[model samples]
Target: MAGVDPDDCCRGAHAAAQRGEFTQATVWDACRTGIRDAIESQLDDEQASPVIIDGLPTIGKTQHATDIAFGLDVPAAILTHRYETRDEHLNLAAEHQKTVAEIPTLDRDCPTRRGDHGSGWAERINDYRSRGASPTYLHYYLQDALPCMQDGDCPYLARWDAVEGADVVIGGPAHAALDRVVDDRVVIFDEDPGTAFRTEFDANQLSTAISTFLRRNDDLPVDNHFGLIGAATNESMDAIRDAIRDELSDNISIASPREAVDDDDGHAEAPTAVLAMLELGGPIIGDTAPAEYDWDDQLREEAGLDYVELPDGSQVVYDHAESRIIIRRPPDLTDSRAVVGLDGTPVEELWRGRLGVDDIESWRILCDDCRARYLRDVIGYTFVQTTSHVKPYSSGEYVNRRADFGLIEAVENRHETAPGVITTKSAAERLFEESPSEPFIDIQRVTNRIADVKHYGALRSSNDFTGTEVGIVLGSPHPGDRPLQITAALEGYTAVRDDEGKGTDLDYGIPDRPFLRHYREHKIAQAVLRFGRTTAATVYIHTGVLPEWLAEMVTAGPETVMIDERSEGQRGVIRALLDEAPGTAAEIAKRERVSIGEKQTRDWLKRLRSEGYVSRDDSQPYTWAADGLADAPHTARVRLPDLE
Candidate 1:
């Protein structure tokens, strides 16, 4: 068994362990043993089992994966969620004296038939693809119509060749195209694979795919395979799901021609429609029978399906309202030597239910005391949330109405300097539009700016807000009620609709809370990590849900502090008395005639202070002063008679 030495851990984890914070240390030790055991146990078996490292965020899971990739004697592949993350790990590998190649994905700048890059080429190619042009058609079209790809000296192909024998290969979730490139090699998923495995397509795209198939095989008997889909789009959700499943079963025999071995890498060519059909809801079988005729002029064959695996645990459901079909299945990892997944919040049911993974080993920090001590003593964080349930929809209303209910003001008051705001991009835009002046950093112009605003989805794999001393999470990034219920239903959990039709009760009679909590709280934790977990920072959450791990570290429980709605005349009178001389609330109230007692005056002062209009000191009398006007002359104080 391999052991993880305290000093061998990442800097943050090492420091935390040295400070007697056992969460990271305990997790690191478990990961070291568990990962090795899982790998070794699989080496002797014909098929390798997956290993998931579910350590807390910033607990060096990525660092550990990097070491494993570089240290392994066999070839390895690392798949990240984004291109930026791949580059980050590439740099991390450099620190360990390992050089790796990044397999780039296609974008607008990729070469087309004309060999031109950017807007013109992108627009032309997009227009062509929008008409249902297959990648094979586009490849042949570019070859005959242009001068660049005729010789087949493509930069994209050359990148794959460059990383041919390298010990490590880094890229994004598009690794399905790699096929045998990662076969029988250890593959590491740097984050949750849920987003990578899930596929979402609207009705229009599905119709276009069916039309593309009809254009090629007009006389074929495959019309029934897609004919019901159009009618299903108008039906109920259950009907839509059943219709698609029936079509998938009907199209099971509609196989492509014998696969042709391409010279570039022996990859089989399947028709565009066939690819789309299988992607929609295909069975997990490996091979299909040869078709009677090939669609394209180029010889095509039924390639052994090595891309997607829709086993017993896969889910296929139709979103009727959106006219969309969502499929959640695991990627085909039949030939991978071993698989390792790293995620901060690893929901095992999600892995089994949504991702369709069955044989997997997980390592996590199970001790509550260890985790709480690590967060409170080692990370040094202060967690606070609003008493009110700031639902996802309410966030937009709060910003649009300019009524944050003192949530924003209280967060601002907690920090001495400006704090970052993490909410929906719509709410952030509204905040920008309603602000009195330009923000210190423009959220639109430069993403790497020291801005005070960061939307929820944009905070992944970013450290730009590390300098931000505080973070005010405005609301939970809940993916609405319907989506949550759909996910819960897909996970085999029953969802009960409300009588009013306003919401759903996914948790009704369920042994535990539904996937809604996991989905929402995972996003909240991701948002909080933007403050740089290694550094000491405070986070004020206005969201209704708080993850159990974070809830343990809450120094200030949820409580509402409404800003006093006193008239400007009464507020000005208190400001006048404070500016004249810093005095106790009772002494100041004695001088002013606001028809309020000392206690009421004190409450009003606290409200004003929270709004940055007044300051109070920790003394026997608790003296109050108009902030920044304590030294002002008598002329600065507005008399009660002068109030408008």
Candidate 2:
């Protein structure tokens, strides 16, 4: 297995995620042996059993997959040609499929040469009826065996040469990888292990299918597609599921019972006829994962009558609440083909049950002591809500100010890594391996304090920071609820769900609260990686949940460590103290146009006095001034106080 370059590993993972695409072998050089061996075992095994290694990111699973793909060049064919060519071909002409295309070239660290390219691949695949055209049936499915990040690099049918042994195929995520699984081959799942069983249903397509079917003859409620029978909303998925199941059973005769059930017959059951008609419609409109024992499967003569159990232990149904749902049955590991998956986190029992595995192979080789980091610091900051009586603490101007103050205080004492505000694009770019710098921040430069965040942000933009001088990176959870948004990108959530994260059979809206917690885990993890790698990176997290790993790492966990005391607004208040008349807290709040009450201002004034930032003047109602400015307090203003 390849070792991580201490300096590059953190940024490499970030870069890998942030970059335009992942194709370079260099981006996947850091790896773990457990992952490598697991994949190799699956490939070498005669029994095609799936394998999964649960571990964390930055531990080198992607690197191992990349290495295996480039190093081992073997070939296998899922569909083959038969000489009897006349008799009938057991080819897959139609069983429903996703988009996949063949390319003639290879680049970005592929390690095999294409020889003996298979024949007949160029033939059009007849959806489920492909075998109808015998002789050339499925002969085109042959491919050269080379481990690749994507199937694009798999050796193609050069001359239809016979391949030996079990085939190993790889992809960027579980969905992509699952597509290439063929008979008698090991399916290596080193990417997106968390998504092994997520099922995405297309609601829009379901609506269309039901809509078109109801147009001809309505045996049931026609409005809104049989009323609640075909509604596309999350809550309606379960009800619609029952409606469809009952309809299929009512119309038992194979070919749609000759004609539609007469509407005038008052056949009050759901339009079983309409549901059957939908099967003939575009498969795109209504889809499910694990190939349910539905009209579609029966229509194709797939010879299966089973429903996959979902992760929640509930029998698989049209579950509407989850945007992505896992189901009971294991994927078709044709011929017992092996599949290996690796991750840092423990494997879920839901997946284990699906894979027919009882125990998860778990281990780790990373820690604060690992040489890959200089300081494995994990900080937890608890902050009080930064809201005044007038407005909620939202991701707007007020929150930005609160964030700036917290972040400044967190990193103020450290003169190590350069400090600046890092947006998602830059953070992922700086961290993921695939994302490389065009021109980026100078990590070595240290600033006294970061101010004017918007302007500082503009200066660090692409080609904006042209100076050789250093740059800054402001730290913490970003102002908005962005951490959770980025969390969706982690485990194939974005692949199956719509922009709103709704699935065909599920709604992901429930995770909004949990996503906030998950996102904080990432924040703390990133803080440990990007900042703790070189110095004791201090992260001030005001919102979202903290990662359990980091929460336990630090003793004084992050609480409402309000740094509101050292802000420009407070500085303005200090400046207001320069009033020649030496006014009270109400007078100061009025001068600054601040909505913060006089009591809050007076409390701050007193706090500033105790911190030696301001001195009280011998006047009525006792006003404050910058230290040593009591005498000339009326005319001259001094610098804002700094953290000692």
Candidate 3:
């Protein structure tokens, strides 16, 4: 097993390919030796430790893990962070001739769907939840009543039985944690399961649940001093806990109001905070602070609680303007069970110190030279950098304007293949909302070539945009200072706050380069890499926040031309014509097949020439070409007309 050869895997894969079987031989051939050696080294150690295989994207990490879990010949579980990746693993495991079972969460399922929770379950739940319907009853129906008393079979629970019988199990991190499936078996985490460990509950949720519990459990001897806001003592928290425990024990079912319209704008959901509070054995208070978390003194005081020592070594903190309490604890991987993690960007301190994994080892399948060779020879990757303002909270007018200019430049330089656009969900939504507006409409030609558009959160472990040669990343996804401070605290880094006593609007507190890179630069990199580095692909990064490693590969792209006082329709036609090959105004207009007349196009071209957006040839049949001025543009704000 220690000598598990890449050549052997390649031979098997080649045989499979000849037989028309599913095979990713190229990836297995590249990194299987490193993976095997890493596993072998870990196996020799007397004490069990988590082994993380750090490899670049599209290197078959998931597939290799699936194969290793299958070879272990035990009831194994593969945990994934994203739904797309989880689904991908399920399919990948099945293809590898492994009996796999999937456990799906009931978060998106309809509560009243007695049977298998058929299609449209998500829509049904969302529709009701959106219309201000109480989710407390829905939780009761789905969790308690339906599973225990319903006539039809419950797919969610039924899958567990299948999981017990299967050789391999595939599911999300949350499911694995809840089911205790990580114990006594080989568990492979496909990505960082931070979301599973980070428990968050808003103050409004606790307040609503407290009010609901008191009103419903009037018979119980519960005190009314459990106020979540303002200065509160431990005694008040105990009263809140007692009330919640009673409510849970009674198992009283509440009917969801069909037409309940509360103007509070809060979901009338279950007593999630109440239940979690009870689970934490009270109001998230403990005697000793945990060593794994760096609790901000001010933040803890604001939340009315600090990092409390628990039996499981978990810690709690408060964050965001919403006043949410967050509890973080690493998933238990004890009892000498083999634990392997798969991640491209492994934050060692985050895993070891913060997540409470004391003894852990990491192995990179591809070194710098190896990865560079892969990128150069196999990927043929080209990087294009831009200076656009892609931050979500930045000025809408400026961000949109810069984004349009950058995208237009990238599109002009791109090959014939369709492009992929990656941005924040808000920016993606704004594309549609402001399609008729100036800057957005100006990038219509670029938008039309977009084969796909994905947000930051959904970019990881996705293959949807692999075929796209050109990828345009709008911005870097920054988690802000509060999260950065929490991460810094967890990873044993000093969080330097400003003299204003404010963590908000501060960027330089956490000096740890890796944490900063992980939270900021890695997001943009992940989005760009989704287009896959295998084969020739040109990536256009629109923001300044990029990693040094990625920045080294940056090449010059076309200049973003800025035009002032240009109408939407006329500007769109001019930009479209500019992006096209060199031709006369009529020729370019005909090539675009736009409704704008040739004369109108020429007039707009002349205006753009005066505005330094384009340059006209001195020939009889004048050729209009974009100037591609990469400098500051005219700042005159003017209202533009809509496209006809």
- Candidate 3 pairs with clashing backbones: none
**Clash totals for all candidate models:** 4, 76, 0
How many Å off is the CA of 152 in candidate 1? Answer: 4.7
1-644 per-residue lDDT for model 3 (tens digits): 12334543332233334455433454455455445545555556647467777667777787777777777645678888777777777777766676777764555333444324454655555555553353443444455444322655445454557777777887877654443566666677787766565545567754554455444545644432254221122444556545544555454322123322332333333333334333432234543332334445654444233334333355544443444555565665664356677777777666665335786777665555445555645677777665534354222333564344444443534355667778776666665346544432444544555677788877667788876777778755666556766666555454545556322233444444666667777777777778755567877777766655666666543243222333554645554654566668887667544557788878866766665667778898998776752221222212211111
**lDDT (Cα, tens digit) per residue for candidate 1, span 1-644:** 12234444332344345565555555565555445555555666756557666666666666667777788777788887776777788888887765688764444114653336446655655555433333344455565653335677445555656577677888775464356446877878777655554545566654544544444444433443355333323223344445444443454322222122122111111232333343433222222211321222111112111122233333454443554545554556777777777777777666655334566666553345556666666667666665346456424554422233234433443444556778877676665554423212122322222237778777666666775667778766656555665565556554443345322233433455546656677778778767757777777766657777777777766543332334433444455564477788888777644456678778877766754567888998898877743222111121111101
lDDT of 2 by residue, 235-292 (tens): 3355455554454445432122112122222121123323432222222234542123
Of 2 and 3, the candidate ranking higher by lDDT: 3
Ranking by lDDT: 3, 1, 2
Ranked by TM-score from best down, the candidates are 1, 3, 2
lDDT against the true structure, per candidate, is 0.54, 0.34, 0.56
- Per-candidate TM equals 0.69, 0.44, 0.68
RMSD of each: 11.2, 16.6, 9.5
RMSD (CA, angstroms), candidate 2:
16.6
